[model samples]
Target: MKERFLRAGAAVLTAAALGAGLSACAPLVIGGGAMVGTLMAIDRRTAGTQVEDEGIELRAASRIRETLGDRAHINVTSYNRQVLLTGEVATAEDGQKAEQIVRGVENVLSVVNDLGIMPPSSLTQRSNDTFITGKVRASLVDAKDLTASAFKVVTERNVVYLMGRVTQREAKRSAEIARGVNGVRKVVRAFEVISEEELQRQLAQPAPVTQDPAAASAPARR
Candidate 1:
């Protein structure tokens, strides 16, 4: 069991390394697909569901901007069709409004509104949050028994929010890893918990193959 998670994490280390180094950059991809295709391939969500999550984030963000404008500082992160709203709003009313907008988005199963009532966080503070996020991500990658790709880490005001489809063991283990990171004030989990049996079944499924660019460019056999 430990060996399986280690192997999976090792498979994506190169891509993850680049992502960690450029933690502040726009998301990096591997194998011409979103978010390091290898990671996505190993993700608990089906490829189609993963795509839907991205759509949910985009649509919800757009709607929030149209409705709230600069009145709030909101970050929308969707995993497994569930939306997590973090950051601050000018007022409690704005926070409630933001949640409603997200819930209205197509295919959003639920919303976890953690929006604070305050002015937008400063650039320096936001930068620190980004740094904290990267540190938490690195901590997860270093955990041998956990498949780092299976989790999504988000930070706001030094609080780390973790989202994923995982077994209870994974949920507990990952939260421990996140809390251990420096500058992480709190760890909030929004995991879709599954049984150990379901996890084993998922692990037994074949992982997607990543083709070598050189081989991909070569002509097919007759």
Candidate 2:
């Protein structure tokens, strides 16, 4: 009973955190402290690559905004230097343009442009998507067989996009969990599939240590 209560509390807190970020339309920082530290420890990408992914997302989003302006409502998510482009574009040409701009960004290993050619989603729709994303993440957290932090969850409209460097088993399991979340219209994967051996090696490595206590306490960007 106590365990269930704790899980419920975690879900609520996580949901609230995620909702705040989504409503603000900002890049998400999943959580702080031990939870995030654990996630960072198990993440497949090197520390440098994780930082690079953040840079790629910021630069790509900026360029897209400058070039496409209000014509696109694009969400940029990068994992292991690969980018996933979601949200709506005014036209098919605008979608292509957005992809081109991201590809031109430095150190972008690849791009998956999943931009829909449609009008921007309503605020209500975005809020609902945020709720779905939060629920999916909380569900993953509650699953004993998975590490929730390994997956990056982003929802647009009613679709949930999952990005990670995961083995096929982890990818399949994560997708199933996300699909079962309420209000999720679709589940999309932009995963970098790694072998089980590689995953085992990652798990075997010690968590990174930092001299800066603040940095050490913060969640490592995936």
Candidate 3:
């Protein structure tokens, strides 16, 4: 799963770098498609975290929520189908309930429950989030060297969440474009990459590193 995510991330970054050099008018459509593709690829790779089990947890959670009513607030994030269930639930039982529900889903390798006991987001906040999401989407569509679809753009309090398969250069270009978008307070990137081989021995290996979410979330450009 990790290997797949790494590869997808590398591909996205490569695309982004390539997009960056493209002329503005030419990038309007292709960039957006590329971005979406990159994001989808990353999502697909992460779904393998359970070693082939994929999106099982997400499906389970959705079904559980539907059965239990909409009161249970849960956010499901899956990478290669390894599910991370975050957000708040009403009670300890609810948390366990979610885990059980997710576990029952086919292909779910594991579930990481980061849910807290809290209320759901207010309507106004949800509206704002939606607006931000739209803006980011539009910006990506309009920008050159950016694929609107290659990125998973999530907005929290005006801060953008960028997750996708991308190369280092593409990531940088994506960030710059996001920073230029209006109403974006910041951009957070949970991007992975493939590094150059080391010359230490006859056989070299890829260097591993955790992506810093904050690095991509810097304040919007002026």
* Model 3 per-residue lDDT tens digits across residues 77-98: 5544445665557788888888
lDDT of 2 by residue, 1-222 (tens): 533544664576566756664575655555545544444455567766877988998999999999998877898989998899999999999999999999999999899889999999877777777777778888887888877667888888888999998889999999999999888889998898989998888888876852434765679899
In model 2, where do residues sit more than 4 Å from their true spots? Answer: 1-39, 211-222
* Cand. 2 TM to true fold: 0.83
lDDT of 1 by residue, 1-222 (tens): 544654455546544544543443233334543335555577788877887998898899889989999888888899999999998999999999999999999999999999999988876677777777767777777787887778888888999999998989999999999999988899999999999999889889987754455666779999
- lDDT assessment of candidate 3: 0.55
lDDT of each: 0.81, 0.81, 0.55
TM-score of each: 0.81, 0.83, 0.48
User: How many clashes in each candidate?
Assistant: 0, 0, 31
Off by over 4 Å in 3: 1-58, 63-71, 77-79, 82-87, 90-105, 108-117, 179-186, 192-222
Residue 161 miss distance in model 3 (angstroms): 2.2
